[model samples]
Target: MEQNYLAPAETMQIHELLNFKTICMTSSKMMEGVVFDQELKTLFEKDVRQSITAINDLQVLLGKAPKLR
Candidate 1:
């Protein structure tokens, strides 16, 4: 037995984009050398670094944070 189903082109395109995201996540997790296909990696890295630096700065400003209070 066989069944046929059809989807519109826009729907197909959205599905493909979702699949691509899944593939990227799988590859990044399973492969050490796999690279991301988007230009945002550099931006993300910079943002992460900046966030770390800010945390460090705040740590110094508060003299080891309010938790030590």
Candidate 2:
């Protein structure tokens, strides 16, 4: 199977995205604990789940990046 490698720039972008998603997920999880409204809490939970999925996808793409010496 042929593998497509990511350019250095793309790799960096994915890293940044992973960091951002992680921050967002963490904040949402923290907020869920303090939120009084069930609807808002549910929304936060949904965001966290979606962030996890996105982070997984980004990691897969990052794996394709060439190793830097």
Candidate 3:
């Protein structure tokens, strides 16, 4: 199997993306409870789902990065 590793800069970028996605997901979930418009609620739901997928993908990439000493 071929080895896959991320450079330090790439690793940092991934970490930032992961954090941003998590925040977005949390915000969407919270807004879902108070939103009165059906269309808006649906949009938030979709965002939450997409964020979850992005976060998972980011986690997998982060796991492949080399550990810092």
Candidate 4:
């Protein structure tokens, strides 16, 4: 049976994965514009897309994050 809510440990793991994926996506996006080689730029674009997909999936598992207020 699948649980609707993640366990605390699992939630933490998902949170960390989300953070890592976001960093990777941001870095790839930053490099894509400045990159001189066409192939390298394409590679960065692919990475950025993949990272975004992963981040979205992880966020789904994490549910709504907390607000400071």
lDDT, candidate 2, residue 14?
Answer: 94
In candidate 2 the C-alpha lDDT for residue 6 amounts to: 94
**Model 4 regions lying over 4 Å from their true place:** 1-3, 64-69
Q: What are the per-model numbers of colliding residue pairs? A: 0, 0, 0, 0
Model 4 global lDDT (CA atoms, 0 to 1): 0.84
lDDT of 4 by residue, 1-69 (tens): 754656677778888888989999999999998999999999999999999899888877777444336
Write one digit per residue (lDDT tens) for candidate 1, span 1-69.
Answer: 754333455445545654554455444444433447445555554555554555455434434222322
The C-alpha lDDT values of all candidates are 0.47, 0.96, 0.96, 0.84
Q: lDDT: which is higher, 1 or 2?
A: 2
| Stretches of candidate 1 exceeding 4 Å from the true structure | 1-36, 64-69
In lDDT terms, how accurate is model 3? 0.96
**1-69 per-residue lDDT for model 2 (tens digits):** 987999988999999999999999999999999999999999999999999999999999989999878
Per-residue lDDT tens digits for candidate 3, residues 20-59, read: 9999999999999999999999999999999999999999
Among residues 3 or more apart in sequence or in different chains, the pairs in candidate 1 whose N, CA or C atoms overlap within 3 Å are none
lDDT, candidate 2, at 17: 98
Candidate 4: RMSD over Cα atoms? Answer: 3.6
